[model samples]
Target: MTDVENVAEDVSLEGFNPFDPATQQCPHQYYAKMRETTPVFQVPGTDIYMVTRHDLVVPILRDTATFSSNFSTAGMSPDKELVEKMKEIMAEGWPPVPTMLTIDPPHHTRFRGTVATYFTPKTMATLREPVTEIVNRLIDELPADGEVFDAVTQLNVPVPIEAIATVLNVPVDMMADFKRWSDDFIAPIGSNPSDERRLEALRGTVEFQHYFAEQLERRRVEPIGDLMSDLVQSRIEADPGDAEKGLDVDDEGKRELTMSEMLSIVSQLLVAGNETTTKALTEGVRLLAEHPDTWAKLRADPAGYAPTVVEEVLRLSTPTQGMFRVVTADTEIDGVPVPKGARLVVMFAAANRDPEVFPDPDAFDPDREGLMKKHLAFGKGIHFCLGAPLSRLEMTIVFEQLGRRLESITLADDNEFMYFPSFMLRGLTGLNVSITRAA
Candidate 1:
């Protein structure tokens, strides 16, 4: 048996499955135990390793050279059947392309650099009025008092989709379609998805590819002031060329983004920008309802405390739970030997709650001291979320509007929080709340 296999035999995983429904609803208890006993554990039935401790996770994320994010399935069983199946399904979609999120350095830098300026704090700040407007408008459409509604459906999902759609320059009416496509695209990627689900995701991928390819063509012809136009028209020098040399001096030295490249990045933004923010908003509202004091404090001073509440919400209920990194070479994580090419799962959610980092880790304390942006909700290192500023803006504006508009809100007794059938994505499938208007 391999060293990893030997190590797995001695460790007691205790039936931990992040994809299980029970675990999704409440994984912190499991995370705490894993942190205590097996910080760098080999998952029982798989060759994948789970890095449960904060200290170990940070180094893995920071040192991308050693731990590559080329793709989650890098070190998977190289069975021909599975390989052929993946290719057959993926062929239905856009041609194979790599975005900033799924690639390592050099290539990652080039892709991310193409549009990083658009996501900068300064650039994102310019959209405050629009974001706030979108929030107020959604709140305006809320049900009258005595009528309850699902927060995830009415508020949480719509708000972020609309905001991101505007950035993508897509029609607001298409937000519903965007949500549907987003769900379908990510469904197959969830933990142990069945063949049927993979086909469904395949359909979504093909449809999305065709739709966005047309958008790229249009933007290339007539440049617009939106992100799509900016991306397609972006020109950066090729590797062998220096900035001192003209970007367009030679074909080898420079290139505009290809159709596949454009599709990859824009589609990535739609998926990443929509799902996590939607989940975060759902949990933020639920957390407030669970802890009335936090809600009361936010309603009392929306401006002063909304930011802190967002941070606390992010820490307590991180939307994207963890990410997989493939080990480039044989390495030791917190002293555990992880063989070369071994895939490691960085438990960002677990790290966020590490006792070493935050006191009373599991407690939802917005007022906790030293709470000045110290969480891995947006991840760390070079791959840190680019749309974080926009997400924060959306949530802050959302909470501020909720405070001003709703007199009171409480989760319905029958409301059983169901998470998406995903090990990576942490979010409520439903969140019904009884709300009152501020009359």
Candidate 2:
């Protein structure tokens, strides 16, 4: 404890397992407790420090130099033998996936740049028509009596995944396989007694790698007019004569985007970019249902679109529950010394709802003109999400169309609002609503 004032009330580790299933399914109460009782706390036996407050957390994520983005695997202690056995079963399908979720600095910047060019707001706008077409076609199928449908399973989930896959030139028929693999990766599987569920995700990952490899190889020969092709063709090659500058590459005539680099790009986008946005729409629709007045206001305006919905939805339910960082060098965070290499997790989900930051934090008010109206759904600074523009574009188009087309909507079932069970992501599982005629 490097000579700090006692402004923060000391918090006990007590019996909090942030990753526990119960905590994940419904983290609002847990987040509220963390916000009030102990904003900054350390879990017992785990070296990870949990920063729960919005104010304290904002700077931690923004100042990446002091706090690192690395994590320790001291907590996930599943039987190794089981992981191995499943690996063997899922052989050839378990190729390692190198994603940007677990990285820092220079390399992160370089990789983000290559993919970012394709998803810039301008570039993303080109996608609106096609995406809207897809949405309309999907909605057109909705019955006139305002038939009940699981928003997640039917429209919200498929839209982005399909859009991304289409852009990548992945076969439409393969969307099912892609979706199944995504589920295996993100959906919780705690009962895997032998970490077999994780093994399955591993298998899916490996298969994904193999698929990308083949796709890259195909792009090498038959160049498709798409982002994937652009990536494979991208060359951050050696700045010639600067012997120390160039990165080693194979015979593929490429540099920077090694197999690892590609894995990092594709895996993160497919998983993080996919699930986060998808979960967001699910949350958005559910919130609108819960708050009919808000829904009615939007349905009338139509222009409020997905942009307004996205902002309000993110404010209401942050998709990224927490972002982890590690202290690289001796630096002070919130005026407290964080020893070198200490892992810190900035809880943005909790922070977004901070009463100090947003008045009536619990309530949904889209038009609340906060100066930082953007929110941290995509984070801030250099490490900000690359796919954000595309995400916003897609979601906005989806919601605007839904808002305009959705005449009447009601709950399909009274099943409790289901949320993705995890510390990192938050969204309802199945937001089934029958839509037509009524606002």
Candidate 3:
């Protein structure tokens, strides 16, 4: 299909506006409607064409040129205000933008490559012993006091953050703050951020950025065993010494990542990489608790079922609800005309649950055979998550240990799940549960 031939015949047609929570709280029903009728309809409200079909979403996610991701939103406008909003989400004084996640190639290529060296799957695998050791020790420390604690507070919360913190060289005493900062940074509210959650998260972001700036300075003065130090040496600029606060010189003496970019990338990794995996573990246990038959199956063979559980959870409950893209020019997406500057929000969670794609989509079936790997939870193409393998490893170990720790598990009386209020993330603040060890 040619690019010009792709746009819908009528540009005036209105699309189903998905940004509204009414559309968000239950997006699947609406997606089904869109895919079934006028799959490429334009929305006068948003000035963008909605792409609901999985087939279309897969390609849109892959094509960065035709569909730019420089501006990230939930199918909203690619307006600078939205980009600025994304920056503010990271931390204030954060350069009116963060790092490579939202930028296009050339800049994104340079920035992403600098961070990739440290996060490769092989590098992550080498740490399994250490990660497993940490998991074992944490479970071993589980209260013998009969408190019947919150698994989230007890297990889910600590593992991933601790692992990444160990990488960042964050101090032990600051671990709680690390969790809090991640929470507040992404949370709709923030006691941890202080003030009215908005201002609080903003302030936390500034301090967070400032800390990385200082860390970058130290790394420049002395080489260290960390990604930050490695980033300090990339070939971004003609001279490493000439690298300024916001942009840096790479090993090749070209523009790589700056100090500000470093903070944004690190902060994004902390929140996105850590929280998603942690929630998957926490929710994995919750699902197991709800279905003992499944939990029993996992306990008996952690290697086999743990992986499927991750996929199942990802399909059923994606950590990221949607990812936005910018239309390069007037383009037809799934037969809809998206003008230049329009934002295309691809709803991963909804697409995963689309009845056309998954049979009985809501059912929690671990053996959800057939095309299961096609799920869009990790996203697609170059933007596919780098932490995927490590995330799989972490969950595998988690369930293996949880199987050994609890004799039996069930949701606590309260059922008080502090679900995040942000449109971007769908994890809870905490989920308390009761447990007993197997004899």
Candidate 4:
């Protein structure tokens, strides 16, 4: 289909609105227009600058010194009252502080180093069997032949949280509570930002702080063989530079992370571990269901072809569409000058389909040549997603088993698929599908 023909009959390129029903249902046409014209353009009604083209986005992702990952620069309130309440929870421990997600180096370098070893490909490789088991357990719960279900709630949402809860050594009984916390934690800043949403997010943050503070205390007394225990016992060896700053340390001169400090790391993991992957899995299923040809190819050789399928789904679906970066100094993107302290919205979804980089960018082709060229789905540079390996693992395993079990799958209705309203996230609200089991 030609670019203009791809757009819904009523929606015009000049009138594009991401939140609009037509655009959300089909965003590729709009992204294509943005790439073809204003690669570095401002949103129609917002000051946020969007970097659409692959060339423009790669530079922003790479130039960490000029573009920071800190979201605080976006000018959201810190909520002083919440800080005061958390002080009691933190006590001698440091209160929730900047984590790898929100901090820029050299502090980002120091903080990421604390947990980087645990996320390496080698460490993540151990999760294959457990993740597969989780996928199978969820699949077993599916109804007997010719039944329908909301895949998002039944599978996509719960499976990832189970994997995350297991990793954190959080009890199975607390799965519901963890899901609640995860929902409330990230809800505040999605598509429709509001006071009510902010309040909900704060409540979740406080509740999470209390629960994890207790967990850290338990791990201190009894070092369980889990990620949480490793974090509780780990300490930062005081450097000579620390002595210059007159910081206190133990006899060995190493400082352990405080309860609140550990909370920051744990919370980021809890949210990152589940949320994006859940959405990605949902979209992956939708993609396969919509394109039977691709589905057939994947099922034929899941073990060999599943990885490539996962990459294509990630590129097209792009769980986290974009993230805010603070410009440190004056810079020009595609020759358009941007001032210092400006908030640049780096659009990963836009770049993933850039025609220059991916031939036939609009189509979903897992066999597309040069498939190994890294896509920004997990991002790039030092701030690249630590959970990328685990996310890919979860999607691949879920589909690998799914391809084997299902003879066919298709959407249950003709209604437009609904998406979560968020400035940064791209996900389905529900995906009802009919399944036909294999004999």
Candidate 5:
């Protein structure tokens, strides 16, 4: 047996709880074992199956018909009391509806289509100047050379939130609330919070919905050229055709989005637009701080190497680690039978580290062969991340700017390097770094 297989064999899967805080801290060993022995692993005492191998993950992601993205059917039962309380709170605002992430093809296509134009590579490229300005401004605010600063709060968090705010034409002054709302949106899925905490988050969600509803109304009456205006003005075909056809918005079935649908889409855009990107930025800094040699290489040629660094960081960090998918029909992943109604944790982070695909997968190697297209960090198939282009652009620019401005980035003496407690999301809670300004 190879060394990886040997290592995999040493780690037992018995009583392995993916949701455990310990597992969340360092899941790589468990993932390695799963990938090698049981690529389709069922979390003990649960109906959820985690798909680990890259080859298996790709097919599962592609076969959206069999593996549905509609997570409502995933058998996740939250606290009844909490649900009732949240429903009561949510009643004050627009009804919550499934938009991009939750719904399947035809509906997903419709929701994704309306805003797709704004996130395309060309459109994202247009924001390069503003994004660069945001990055530099944040860097300027960092403490003087050789001082310890919390990169997570000072730089990583603000950069993406501000950039996304710029895109959505939302006021950056409301950034704290924006971050809180974003956290609330993913609270149930990402952080397995307490009933009280969950209720608090729901209240925040209601506030978010109300705030965006007003924004949508303003955009409707007077269409500004921002993303919100585009979303408000854009019409979709009334008859959302089959998934295969993919978003056929002809004049025949043209209609504006309902208030609920508009709210849902905007909520998704806000949460997804900033949250994952924030995590990616945090992870990138952590990775750089850990590997001075890699940082040195990146500093040597910021423009040429920043993109590669971004991909490597994405591959290794994998901010949005795993996305939940439900089995529509009875299916078998790599001969492991998964019953209908079973929930599948499509492990993108694990897949990125699959040795069969990405050799020496754990190492931060920007020069890895086929590094650009191989990593599933942005995910694969139709339900791929909509904000991927924007995320990439932000990372590329931030890293380049860091490379130019900072002489060296080293972990602070007091750095704990702890990640946020989330089974689905992997991001450092904070990263304290000491930097020397480049001459």
Candidate 6:
């Protein structure tokens, strides 16, 4: 079939509103249409451009000079009333600043360097034992055989929260609060949240800032050799010599992170550290239950199949659906004109399913060879996820444990899969499944 004939008849981009919750639920149809017809699409009546194709997204991610990561420069402001109210609440805490995801190049380089050593493979290797212990403990608390339970709550949620807590040297007892604060931090992203929801999110943000600010202070006075202690003591060196090379490293001089900067980075780690993994884990369970044949293979050799399963889950689920990038100057993508200050929503989820990149992209094939590393799920270029090692460790352990402990897995009778309403994130609100223990 020709490319035009290959397109689905029902797929129409007319009045496409990605922010709509319905569109957020099952966007594959629209994504396919975008990839085929208009790889670079502008949302109707908005300055936002959606970059859907895999080929197009990589260059945008690499060209930090043209497509900036500093979203504050995008000039997109929130509701005036909501902004005013949030300001009042946020004023009580340390002011928010762009630390990791929001800044580009030299600023990003220095900020990421401070905490980069903590998430290195060598560091993650030391965490395997403790993380495995946490996984087994959570698995031990699962419901009896043939009982229905929410995998998200029982397993997916706690595994990462507790693992990150262990890494940060915080009390695992406060995991419930940690999860809540993480949710609150990303509450307003990718949606037109109600005034009430926005205010609530602001209050929760202040609460988180206050709570972590104390922990950061404690680390300063009493160095405990934890991640927080490292953050408190880490310093960046001045490199004026590199400025002429377009490195932008000399502006801030040599310094430790400001209290506000530390809080911002910690908030990101708390949210990114757990939220993405939780979504991916929940989706993995759902996929295994839906595709029992794949689960059966995993059951046969849990450890052997786990690494691929992790990659497949990350690709298919793509917890972070897309991210915003502000255009630094007027540019054209694939011959289409894009104006300066226009925001680009680089669709990682859509790009993962680009048929050109992954043959039969929709299939849940764990054994799919060679393409595992090609998915942009962990992202591309300089802003690639820092917590990838830890996430992979947690997920690999969970799948292995699930395969070893469960004889059968299936969706609950009344279960209706529902994702959280956000364009930039894709995660099931809950996943209810009935399972039989391995004999």
Q: How well does model 1 score by local distance difference test?
A: 0.80
Please list the residue runs of candidate 5 whose C-alpha ends up more than 4 Å from where it truly belongs after superposition.
1-9, 73-76, 239-251
- Ranking by lDDT, best first? 6, 5, 1, 4, 2, 3
Error of 3 at 146 (Å): 6.8
> What order do candidates take by TM-score, descending?
6, 5, 1, 4, 2, 3
Q: For model 2, what is the error of residue 95's alpha carbon versus the real structure, in angstroms, after optimal superposition?
A: 5.7
Winner on lDDT (2 vs 3): 2
**lDDT per residue (tens digit) for residues 95-198 in model 2:** 44334556666646666767777777677777888888988887787666656668788888878887787667678778777777677656442222236567
lDDT string for model 4 (347-436, tens) is 888888887887766677888766556578988888888878788888898888888888888888753577776647778888888788
Selected candidate, larger lDDT, 2 vs 5 = 5
RMSD of 4: 3.7
Model 1 scores worst on lDDT over the 10 consecutive residues at: 1-10
Looking at model 3, how many pairs of residues clash?
24
225-342, model 5: which lDDT tens digit per residue? 8778888787776764523345445556676777888889888878878888889888888778778898998899998999999998899888888888989888787898999999
Against the hidden true structure, what lDDT does model 3 obtain? 0.67
Clashing pairs in 1: none
Query: For every model shown, what is its TM-score relative to the native structure?
Result: 0.91, 0.87, 0.82, 0.89, 0.94, 0.94
Candidate 1 TM-score, true structure as reference: 0.91
Model 6 has an lDDT value of 0.87
How high is the CA lDDT of each candidate model?
Answer: 0.80, 0.68, 0.67, 0.77, 0.83, 0.87
Error of 2 at 91 (Å): 6.9
TM-score of 2: 0.87
Name the regions of candidate 1 deviating beyond 4 angstroms. Answer: 1-12, 72-89, 239-252
* Local accuracy of candidate 1 as per-residue lDDT tens digits, 214-254: 88889889988778888887865565644454434355566
Assess the local accuracy of residue 223 in candidate 2 as a C-alpha lDDT between 0 and 100. Answer: 84
Candidate 5 or 3, higher lDDT: 5
Which candidate do you rate higher for TM-score, 2 or 5?
5
